[model samples]
Target: MRKAGWNPIWKWLAIIAMIFLLAPLAIALLNGPGGSSGLYPSPNAYETISNASRSITRLPFDYDTSDDVEMLKEYVESNREALSEIDKALTQQSRVPLDYTVPLDELLNASGTVRLPMRLLIVQARVAELEENPGAAADVYAKMSVLSPKLATGGLLVHVMIASAYETMALEKLIELTPRLSAVEKKRVLSVLTTNARKPIDFDLVRERESDYCKHEHGTVRGSILLWSGSALVDQQVDRAIETDDELLRLRDEAIDLLGS
Candidate 1:
């Protein structure tokens, strides 16, 4: 009689164990694989950017004084070929292409590398401004403004945030330089800002890519359990990020309008 009672208990324990084991599997299966099947942008610009990122030397000081400008000029001359390639790439397309299938580490590495060129551009703009060529400075800022949007497109949240930062930096520089720019240069800069403001970053796509990244990271059973359990919180955080991006873009547009006026 004791053995019979023990058998039911063992069976119940087995059922509970199975439920624990299979629940994550079931959740993962139901969610299906994340990632998009849509066509991505051409990799040419991204390839160029990656190549350019390799040749850059980190600048230690801000591009403020004549000495700083000279340092920037030296950096620019040293990375001239790479910077040229980046400029050519920028003219070709308005979006930075990334292989979403790459590992998280690779994407993070890319995030770090891509910012070098933006820094280089800022240096170049400052050099021009200090040289008393406000038109050239405005041109560099315009390119920075345009490239900022491109970097955010078809990227993860980190990329979007980086782009947003660059955009703000470029806008501030342009605003400071606007009074010095010729009427034609001001109009051109205003036009670029207007166009970029109109095409806001697509947070929907960013959310999807983020989910895909999580799926990629948590493919194992143990990982899946953690992911499945924490997905609600992850999604909530992502939504909050999206809202933040929306507000930032709105303010950016308002700033652009002020630039135009």
Candidate 2:
């Protein structure tokens, strides 16, 4: 069921976002270099894109290790042409609606696997912010949001991304800059989080199944991260910031409360 403020346009945005986050992973998993016949076309291109994405996603975390960085650099350097081709393919794919329906068992098994890329991107964006490239970091996050338009309510990944972005972006610079901006801008930034604070997503009983995919050891990490990050972001940043700014406190509280009622 759709939420009250659910925008139809966002549904399209969500599909594009999903393609950006998943197409490569899909390709890689289905048709790696040694992959035989697979469901999707263009296995070679997909494999290249997948390898590069994995490297890029892991790059931020393993930055302190020289060997890891070198391997990533080599992968990127060798795959430049393949990367460009796949990037174009993804952009083209984004224009079309994704057909998410699959055999039930397949969908359930794939759900846990599908979320890994988004998690990687979230970490990538956070690391980008830490590196002081807020623009690039925001771009990474914008892609993440575009992929999950229902992010506000659909699942754990969105919640974590929102909280991490808010804490990293909001507490660091956005809060400081808030005093200088107009009321409207402040409201807009705060409003981005309102959906997630309320309207939690229904994952179609995926969370309740006794299958391996539903287990915490395998499946629930995405949602767990979301719960932890969102709670922490709200507690540390939103709650703390309002302590110093009465006007902001009111606005933030109202945004969250309105969503609940």
- Per-residue alpha-carbon lDDT of candidate 2 for residues 1-261, written as tens digits (9 for 90 to 100): 966875789988999999889966664454332211114433332233334444443334453233443454454455455335434433322111112333445543433332434445445445554555555444444343333322212223323334333334333333333444445544454455542332223333212221222222332444344435555654554334334334333444543343223
Clashing pairs in 2: 17-147
TM-score, one value per model: 0.77, 0.29
Model 2 stretches with alpha carbons more than 4 Å out = 1-104, 150-261
Best by lDDT: 1
Q: Write the per-residue lDDT of candidate 1 for residues 174-198, one digit (tens) a residue.
A: 7677777777877877776666444
Candidate number achieving the greatest TM-score relative to the actual structure = 1
Q: Candidate 1: where are CA atoms >4 Å away?
A: 1-22, 35-37, 57-67, 94-103, 195-198, 220-224, 228-240
